[model samples]
Target: MSGDLLATDIEAYLDAHEQKDLLRFITCGSVDDGKSTLIGRLLYESKLIFDDQLAALEADSKVSGTQGGDLDLALLVDGLAAEREQGITIDVAYRFFTTDRRKFIVADTPGHEQYTRNMVTGASTADVAVILVDARKGLLTQTRRHSYLVSLLGIKTVVLAVNKMDAVGYDQSVAAAIDADYRQFASGIGLDDVTVIPISALRGDNIIETGPNLSWYDGPTLLEYLETVEPVGAATGGPMRMPVQWVTRPDPSFRGFAGQLVAGSVAPGDAVRVLPGGQTSLVERIVTADGDLDVAVAGQSVTLTLADEIDVSRGDVLAAAAEPPAVADQFETSLVWMSDQPMLPGRPYLLKIGTRTVGVSIAQPKYKINVNTMEHTAARTLELNEIGVCNLNLDRAVPFDPYEVNRDMGGFIIIDRLTDVTLAAGMIHFALRRADNVHWQSVEVHKEARAAQAHQKPCVVWFTGLSGSGKSTIANLLEKRLFADGRRTYLLDGDNVRHGLNKDLGFTEADRVENIRRVAEVSKLMVDAGLIVLVSFISPFRAERRMARALLEEGEFVEVYVDTPLEVAESRDPKGLYRKARRGELVNFTGIDSPYEPPEDPEIRVDTTTMTPDEAADRVLRVLRERAILPSAGG
Candidate 1:
């Protein structure tokens, strides 16, 4: 064919595909259960694979094919070299194909146990899941795992393909037994709509076309069902929610909020509310690139112009005024942990929902669900590939719905702030009652009044350094000196507070973080009480220290780093911790096994090697006087 003729044909095909409705589905099962082969067969039988691609598959199959002297259909979707060589799918491979009836995008996901996160990613958007079961093996552990994940992701439709029928001699009884067992299991998991089919993906039986061998099975073929199943319905006529992606203002006159409508519809004159602030406005115009739209429904990208100039920006959600989503700074959520680092409570991460990103911290895990048994086991932390229930505390309030109500508004991702890697995917269950009910009560006597009454500035002197670095000794002497000078002060020694407030916490990284968090909160309360709070602890992590600093007013939390060399501190070994660590009896010992991150820009740096404890206390007091934290010596 001529180049122009080929171009015309391709253009025509593309146009047809654009016109057809799309159905996104996923294929998953145990490893080597022919998931890739089933998808590859669908593409091959539908004539979607190009001639050159077919030629390449044939060439590659001769050396790496699992099947001898036959085209390895699995090679088509298992595109990774390692996958092709290992005869297993390692990642989710998505392929788009169109039949005469409809257009389909299928995700062939990995079936291995370790790749559950990959499966969750692919299934998150799928309308239906086709779970392949090896006929000889029947139902395996991974089959149940993938099935549970599919259900958890809200995939309503399920197709259980009993594959490798040829290997089991196409026996109807074997297929029947497996189908009965799966139906029983699926019912228990709330999977109501399930269709079972017997097929041999390797032999291409009952996949694209029905074969005489499976004449006993009277059901639609896989392609027939895929082409006919209804596409997942859009959230039209629901409460409108459009998370602002960009604030488009090219010229002085035009200011529009641009985003895809995730739910409901909007037209000119419709009332909308900007969320988390509850600012109401009328839709002045629905702007599109071509022209102004009369109406914009779910899934359409449009810019909205408000009748009134309100506080609207990127990361803000615009919702239907009457049915706006709930605004809260805390939520109970189900999380799928995806990172190798275990989730630690009180450690801040980035929570991204819709287009908005906010500082968030996951509370301790309520429980973790064992996918194999569906048992809820109590857990403190979530490791890789685990699912758990936990509370998420956001730095500020944001609008959202329950995941059951609106996936787009309720779904979120937790990102590591420093590494920028996605650590987990979460779905909001409900907002915590405390988030709405707990309000700071206004008091007539404020911080200034309390400080004036005490005759000293309310401050928290935070002493952070390595163990045996004399932080506690210097802080004790400093508190004694301040008390002698008529300053109202209290020293919160680390070991003393740990016995009562942080008694349950150990020396693990996570426990240490929680320990510091509790102490920081206590110090903030003490500062509010107009007392000089001296906190002497080996607060190691910089992030946690910064968190403490953020909780205080400007210049209120003074970080005092006791800069003693590690050699000197270790040689001193006042607590005998370094000796125990050297004997391998102590784990996560700071300055020995675990890290001790010193303050980079502390307000005061006291070198213990150059000064005695009393001298260090004098130096701190002199700095306080210079900073006006204390009254002048003469005054």
Candidate 2:
């Protein structure tokens, strides 16, 4: 039928292709598991490769072929030079093909454990997961890891293709054993809909057609199943939701919200409500570039004009008035840590969900999942490629559904606030109960009123440096000077707070972040009471220091860097910490085992190597006066 359509009627072939359903799937498994070969075979069988591409694949196969003197089918998709030279996939390679029944977008992802994050990225939007396993190395570590990820990403359909049956001599018992083992593992990981098949991608045994070697196996070929199996349905039946990507205003009288509808459908006169704000209005028109649309369904990008002019903006969700998503500032979530740097609790990151990006921080992980055994082990932090359950706290409220209910609304990515690099991918399970129960109570006496009564502006003077760099000494002297000037001041020394407020915390990176978080909160409360709060600590990470600064308003948080060289601080060794760190007695000691990030731009820089403690304190006092935190000496 495909040959006749191409030979006789090009228009007919184009029409049939346009009407065919599209399936987006990913091929993932352990390294050298034939994921690329399987995709190449699929494209080859579908006749999607151009003549020039086929010539290149054939020529390159001889020079870089792992299969001596034979055509290396994996070269068809392993296009990267590094991938070809290493004989392994380093990045995801995508290919498009069409059969008589359907069209496909296949992602051939890297199978190495280090590239698991790349697999997650490819699987995020997939409708199916075709997890390949080398029949010789049945059910390896990455097979289980990818299987667990497939389940976590809410992929309902999975085809467990056991490849290289030709190598295993078409052993039915071996295939049966692997099937049983994978079924047990899949059941444990909540993967219910899975189909297992044995094939040799190198030889094209059971991919497009059943070969004579697999006479004992009675199942559809991989192509047959893929063409017939139903793809996961889109969210067209769920609550209507469209996150405003932009506000389109082309003319003086025209204003519309532009976005792709992620769920359900909308029509003219449909009542819609803006989320995280709860403003209601009726949809007046659905505008598209082609013209105005009377109706728009999920997955359609359109511009919507409302009957009433409301405060709808980008990052705001437009939803069905009666069935809007939940709004919360905290959520219980499952996180897949992707960065090489371990996830640090209490350190601020950015959470980007839908079109919205908000300031967010992760709490201590509840537990990390062991992909092999499916066990929940206690975890303090998540390292690279680790999956963990954690609670996320956001600075502002966001509207979302449970990931199981709506992928677009519930899925989010954690980005480094300073570098803007994505650190992790997370799926929301549900909003924490505390998010609903906790509310800020209205106060009669606010910070402005308290500051006015005290006759001075409130601020947090955060002193950060190496442990022996005179942060505490300079802060103490500065506090005494302020108090002598009739200023209400409170000094929070790091060591003093550790004995009381942070007694339970330790010296790990995660613990240090938490320590700074607690101290920052306490300082915020003190400043609210119209007092000058002096915070002295070895606040090493810039992320945590930035978190502390974000708690206060602009100009209300003054960073005073107490600068001293590591050698100078070690020689001073006021508390013998550097000696202990060098002797391996103290772990996670800043400037030794751990790290210390000096402020790039501080309000005041006090170099203790060049000045005495009194001079350092006097320099900070002068900066405070210039910033108007304290009254002038004449006043």
Candidate that scores best on TM-score: 2
- How do the residues 66-178 of candidate 1 rate in per-residue lDDT, one tens digit apiece? 77857988889999989876788989999998787788899999999889999999988888999999999999999999999888777878999999999999999999999
Q: Which candidate is the best by lDDT?
A: 2
Q: Over the stretch 160-254, how does candidate 2's per-residue lDDT look in tens digits?
A: 99999999899998889899999988998888888999999999999988989999989999999999888564435788999999998889899
TM-score of 2: 0.96
Question: RMSD of model 2, in Å?
Answer: 1.8
Error in Å for residue 553 of model 2: 2.1
TM-score of each: 0.94, 0.96
CA deviation > 4 Å runs, candidate 2: 7-9, 232-235, 632-635
How close is each model in CA RMSD to the real structure?
Answer: 2.6, 1.8
Model 1 lDDT, residue 449, Cα: 88
